[model samples]
Target chain A: DVKVTQSSRYLVKRTGEKVFLECVQDMDHENMFWYRQDPGLGLRLIYFSYDVKMKEKGDIPEGYSVSREKKERFSLILESASTNQTSMYLCASSLGGGPNTGELFFGEGSRLTVL
Target chain B: TQLLEQSPQFLSIQEGENLTVYCNSSSVFSSLQWYRQEPGEGPVLLVTVVTGGEVKKLKRLTFQFGDARKDSSLHITAAQPGDTGLYLCALWAAGNKLTFGGGTRVLVKP
Candidate 1:
């Protein structure tokens, strides 16, 4: 079984604060993603890393950045958090190239509250 | 940008009832997937349908892909209380990206 672990399950931060959310996958998958889920709006991608030191922005990447210093770890950074950034963050990983590449294994989401 | 529109944003039914959730899109997709998410947890992949007009079954759940690959549907038979959750349809687009629908929240009462 693949395991994707998130560093924090819950977080609280003030506005304009810098926030860091870490994710680690044990399956050694090459693809990792960050998404934020909000009511009515659904889940929107924040950023994704295809390999170590490689990252790409997703649909809603504003006010967010990502770091992929290692193959097993991908991090999401909010340079300056705002109340609008408060939501559930999810991390997922998958095998890089194959017919089943779209199958994503996700970690328990981290709920961040920006006050 | 490609978009997936899911119907019946919310459903409430008694146990042993049958229900279907639909996902429609104007843009063509290479493949589509279904996922179920519980509260406080990330979504889990339920099934993936790639071929046009293809159908797959998992227990009492049935998934079908449109012949044009632009839509999909999930049907649950005799839904149980344990089946209550959010059902989401997603598409695998170019650049290895997965776009998700807004999801349908289902509640099954005992």
Candidate 2:
């Protein structure tokens, strides 16, 4: 069974505070993603990385950035958290890139509350 | 970015009942995926439909892709309490990004 582990299950941070959400995949997958799930907007991708040091912005990357310094570790960083950034954050990894890739293995999401 | 729409924002039914949810898009897709997410958990892939007019079944669940490859449907028969979750539909777009629709929240009462 492939496992994607999220470092934090829940976090509460004040506005303007810097925050870090970490994720690690044990399956040695090549593609990793960060997404924020909102009530009526669905899961909007924040960023994705296909290689260790390469990252790409997704549909909703305005308030977020990502780092993939290692093959198994991907981190989402918020330079300054705001109240509107409160949401459930999810990390996922897949085996390959492009249209023919396999299913995504997701972590138990990290719920962040910005006050 | 591809736009996908899921209908019936919420559904509630008793165990042994049947329900169906839909995902629609105007743009043709190379493939579509269905996922089920339990509370506090990330979405899990249930199935993928790649061909137009394709039909696939997993146990009591039935999935069908529209003939035009622009829509898909998930039908569950005799739904149990374990079936309660958020059902999400996603499109595998270019660059390996999965564009998702607003999910259908299903509650199956036992």
How large is the i-RMS for each model, in angstroms? Answer: 2.0, 1.2
Largest TM-score belongs to which candidate? Answer: 2
In the range B27-93, model 1's lDDT, one tens digit per residue, is 8888888999988788999998889999999999999999998889999999999999999888776
Per-candidate local distance difference test: 0.90, 0.93
User: Native-vs-model 1 lDDT?
Assistant: 0.90
Please give the lDDT score at residue B100 for candidate 2. Answer: 90
Q: What CAPRI grade goes to candidate 1? A: medium
TM-score per candidate, in order?
0.96, 0.98
Candidate achieving the largest DockQ: 2
Q: Report the lDDT of model 2 for residue A69.
A: 95
- Encode model 2's per-residue lDDT on B34-76: one tens digit a residue: 9999998899999999999999999999999999999999999
Candidate 1, A1-115: lDDT as tens digits: 7899999999999999999999999999999999998875667888988899999888999999999999999999999999999999999998897433568999999999999
**Candidate 2 Cα RMSD after full superposition onto the native fold (Å):** 1.1
Give per-residue lDDT, candidate 2, residue B106. 96
Off by over 4 Å in 1: A98-100
